[model samples]
Target chain A: MSALRLIARDLRLAWTGGGLWLPILFFLAVAILYPFAVGPDAKLLRATGGAMLWIAALLAALLPIERLIRPDWESGFLDQLAVRGWADEAVAALKIAAHWLSFGPPLLLATLVGAALFDLDGDMAGTLLGGLAIATPALAALSVTIAALTARAGGGAAGLMLLPLAIPVLIFGAGSLGPNSVGAMPLLAAVSLGLTVLAPFAAGAAMRALRD
Target chain B: MEQRQAEPAPDAVVIDRLACLRGGRLVFERLDWRIARGTLGLLTGPNGAGKSTLLRIIAGLLRPAAGSIMVEGRVALADERRALDPLPTLRQGLRFWAAMDAQPATATDRVLESLGLAPLADVPVRMLSTGQTKRAVVARALQSGADIMLLDEPMNGLDKASAALMAAALAAQVRAGTTLVLASHIPIGIDPTTTLDMAI
Candidate 1:
């Protein structure tokens, strides 16, 4: 029940704080700007649009990282939760779930615009969406974990640290968008599963360490 | 304020041979204390004397360099930091914790009234003044329903009247069978059953 309340609270905060919209706006901006940069060549746009969308999603995921866990840590929310007999892992897990719920679906939905802008064929768009479905959880996990780790240090350190760690998810997710790389979808899901499983514990340990 | 019949407090918190280290320096060593049921403990110390550190250790937020702490019931801490969300109204922020603590939302009403925050209840927490924010933190600790509360500098930002109200509410909590360990440099106007004074 408490976990549900926390998840609800997180979602509410994300929505009210405009955190959820930032990523979508960023994704759309990237899609919109790409054509201006590369010119209106349909062949070029169709060929690279899916990968650009994937890149946009990855960058958009980074938008929420700095605020994700630091404010809670500074405000002593984490300590209060710990005292309430909520394990750190449980708290981290709930935050990750909330983060995913806030960004993952919206990002998927925004893919329609991405498809239109990028001139992606239906097949490529389907593959891109499928890849994101398998991969966004991993992205959320990575962001949440890095957010916890750099929570006390502050600044853009978390974002810088996150990029390298997220490379595998990006590689697999973007790779799965290729015509011949349909087999990468399962591998992407596998990586996401590993990250989703490991993130809570890693983030929880970092939170505990911050108390010192 | 009416004094209700005192209930027998069932909780006890004991810290033995506790040592704390901060920034590679030992803040304190071999500190021993016990807060038994129905008693108030004042942890008094000068600056840099580890008053807050000891409270954090007791609250299990920080690991003691070497020691054992046995707390028989739920423990809560209200320190210099306000734990409530800044985005929410005072009432909503307090309600979040009350919900987390599995208490009814009405639990916050009594706390709000006690701390004279009833009028400001609808104000966003970020808009609250310093003293009001401090009172809100106290209100949160009071409503926590924890058997043992470790409060660090509980009266830091309060004016005299608000501080007195906080003292009365804390005294009420003790009367209602909650064990309290308050760390404050100023006199809170309530006599503690035991006082642990630390020096640098």
Candidate 2:
């Protein structure tokens, strides 16, 4: 019951955050504008669409995590949860799951809209969505750790810290669409899968750090 | 004044030798204290005295920089990481943290009333008038069911009525045979069985 209460509180805060629309707008605006800036040749748009979609996807994935964690920290909810018979790992998992639910699927569908706008064909669209589906969990995992680690520093700075670390997700997400190299897409997917599994450790460490 | 006793309780909290560094300052060195369980104890001291520091050290929240402590016959501050994965028993340890110092005003009113908070519990913990927060904390501690209670400034925010309630809770817990150790600037109970004044 206690664990559920903590997670529900986080989900409610995320749902109520007014800025959720801003990221979607930013994603859409960036996706559409980049093509025009680089010259709107259909062929070139097709060529760069995967990369642009992935970049937008990265920002979208990265954006909500800090927001998700900030309210909890500011409210001192995290520390209270820790004291309330909750292992930090369980707490981290709940936050990550909540992050994925709120951001992952919606962001994937948005990517679909962007890909269509960029004129990405059927096969590429499937791969883009597939990669995103696999990658979004990993993104939440990353956010969980970074948010936990930098929670003391406050929210905005934590988001900035995560911006640079998004390189791998960006690489693999876009790489999923570019070419048919046997290992590339799988490796990317595998990394996200791996990160999805591994982030709990980092998140738990962050929880312990905050307690100390 | 004679020390009060609830039941036949443990006779001592033995700190063999204690040490801790808080925020880079060495708060204590080889400090020793032996207080029996179920006995009223007071640690009186002026401001900046290592009173809270001593509580943390005893509670195992802060590791002694050196030496050791055995509370009622167990390593109260044992390093759980190295000692063993499964503790023999955790029932003996009871820790209740404050509302993390939030204000007394409340965003939601229901949580206040449900906890019998009514008008006062509605406020954020920080915004809560001292006595109101005290009542809430004591109410929460009662619900928590921890065997050992470590409270910091339990009476800092209470009125006469609430302070009486605080005294009632402590007496009731002692009646129910719960070990109570609290630190406070203001006195809630008319009589404390054992008062260890840190105000030396």
Candidate 3:
């Protein structure tokens, strides 16, 4: 019940901060623009549908994460939340899950619509959503861990530093629908979950560092 | 003054051979401290005496490099993850962790008319001022049903009036057989019952 309350509190904070809209705009706009920058030809755009959709997702899913944990860390609530008796893994899961609910699903839908507009293959849409379903939690968990690691939140450069770490998700999420089998997508998912569980320990330690 | 037995004497907290090093800087080296039953002990030292670090370790919120803490006749923090016992997690109710700093926690309110916080019963703990926060911390120590309370600087950041309230609350707790190992510089108004100079 308290976990839900905390999650609800996070959602309320996210909503007031327009966390949803900024990413929504960025996701949609970038989805619309990247193909044109690469090439104006519709044929090239059509050919690149799967890649474009996944890339847009990776970009969109990641943009808000830079700001994801700043408030909680700054507020001193992260350590307090840890001490609240919920298992560390459970707390980590709830934070990542809430983050995904607010940011991931909307971006997925936006990407699906973008894919349809671009005449991307139907199976690739399935891949986009499925891969994202597998990967969004991973993205959130990894971001939380990295943010916890850096401790000094709100650094714009930190997000960029963390982006390369998600390349596997970008790779598999974009290519999982390929003619050849994509075995590594699930592997990417596993790594993300592993990070989620382990990140809390680091986050707890980082918080000790922060307290001083 | 002879037969003063209100609440039973709780167990002591034993911290032995505790050492901690952060980034190669030794905070403490083989420090040993023992907090007895029902005594209000103060932890004092200069700026870097590692008072908060020691408190965190005692609270089972952090781990010591080489040492152990036992409380209530049991290993207090055998595993960094475990406490005196996994003090039952707050399932649903009002709680006063640091989060309340921005969330408005009250430390006291009269009966008959309650605010939007029945969950915060047993004595208000949300919407509290600094002294009130300390008082609430003590109230929580009482409510926690824990025999021993580990308070860090129980008097810092509190005004004189709030300090009196806190002192009274501490007195009440100590009188109830609740031991307090507090970290503070300013007198928390309790007759300096006991003091442990961390600088030593």
Best by DockQ: 1
Better of 2 and 3 by lDDT: 2
Q: How do all models score by TM-score?
A: 0.96, 0.77, 0.72
Ranked by DockQ from best down, the candidates are: 1, 3, 2
- What DockQ values do the models have? 0.77, 0.10, 0.11
Cα error, residue A148 of model 3, in Å, equals 2.1
- Measured on C-alpha atoms, candidate 2 has an lDDT of 0.62
| Model 1, runs deviating above 4 Å | B1-11
How well does candidate 2 match the true structure in TM-score terms? 0.77
Tens digits of per-residue lDDT for model 1, B68-154: 888777888898889877788999999988888888988999999988899999999999998999889888889989988888888
lDDT of 1 by residue, A46-80 (tens): 99889999889887877888777998898888998
User: Between the candidate structures 2 and 3, which one is better when assessed by TM-score?
Assistant: 2
Q: Worst 10-residue stretch by lDDT in candidate 2 chain A? A: A75-84
Model 2 agreement with the true structure over B1-200: per-residue lDDT tens digits? 13434445555466666776778887667666666665555666676667766666666545678887775522111111111101111111111121212212231232233334565432334454445544554454554445555566666656666666567667776666555666666665746666656543
Clashing pairs in 1: none
Q: Model 2, range A67-128, lDDT digits (tens) per residue? A: 65555655444544544445778888888887777777678768778888889899888888
Q: Which of the predicted structures, 1 or 2, would earn the higher DockQ when compared with the native?
A: 1
In model 2 chain B, the worst 10-residue window by lDDT is B78-87
- Best by the TM-score measure: 1
Question: CA lDDT, every prediction?
Answer: 0.88, 0.62, 0.59
Task: State in Å the error of residue B16, model 1.
Answer: 1.4
